[model samples]
Target: MKKSLVAALAVFSLVNAEQISIGGTSFERVDALKAYEVGCASNDADACFEAGWIHYQRQNLNKAIELYTRACNANNYKACTNLGALYFSGEGVKVDIKKAKELFSKACELGDGDGCNNTAFLYEQKKDIKTALKLYKKACDLGHQIACGAYKELSK
Candidate 1:
């Protein structure tokens, strides 16, 4: 009966236990931010990206930018794309289309479809239809559905 009771409690706990693993440590959902932060501090690229995303969702853009920069430097494509998006949208930082283009271009070269799509957007904004069309096609080929639609529209 004691064993059964212990097993029942364990099951109950697991029902509410969403876990995030960082650096071989498992953290519960409520502790995910701290876990990611710890991992980021240890120079884990994926952890930095996760922490950056959490900070962004929490409206802590400066922290997000810092963490994202670290991850981006480590060649985390998602981090580069996300940082580029922040610069592109002027969210929490002044709009810097130049920086956005550089970051997005880097991510595209790293094979992220969103990066290609975003780079195409910057070119489109500059009225460089030919460049934008080429990038949009590349983005579409890379599996960004939105870019496919944009490419179709531009083709017309």
Candidate 2:
């Protein structure tokens, strides 16, 4: 993680946005990204996720990674899964399967179906079919559509 991201998070942690608010704030649909950025700067995990997603759409992968790292550190499962996807696919950063597995495992621990499914895929790649099957079952139970199919295929 970059020092800048950590520094921003540390600073945000010291102050609450609402405590410093002077007047009413309106978050228009068109300005949603701006609102998310403000909220993220205030250390809101969901806002960090929204901001990261916006950055990702804009092809600002470094910014997205920083914000996603913040959100993931805050125990936001979606952010963990997305961060793992980035590492797994080598989109903006170098491919690191171990890091991706670790992040996906964290997301799975937080009850994300996508995370469970992804973890299972990695396990399958390593030829650990039993573990993969178990993870696939868990993911399937959690409503990961692809995991359901994978589980059935592996069961045969």
Candidate 2 residue-wise lDDT, 1-156, digit = tens: 332443344344443222222123333322555556777877878878977987897799999999999999999999999999999999999999999999999999899999999999999999999999999999999999999999999989
Over all chains combined, what TM-score does candidate 2 have? 0.80
Q: Estimate every model's Cα lDDT from 0 to 1.
A: 0.83, 0.83
TM-score of each: 0.79, 0.80
Candidate 2 regions with alpha-carbon error over 4 angstroms: 1-30
Clashes of each: 0, 0
Residue 117, candidate 1: alpha-carbon lDDT: 96
Query: For this target, which candidate reaches the highest TM-score against the unseen true structure?
Result: 2
Candidate 1 C-alpha lDDT tens digits along 63-137: 999999999998989999999999989998899999999999999999999999999988999999999999999
User: Model 2 misses residue 75 by how many Å?
Assistant: 0.8
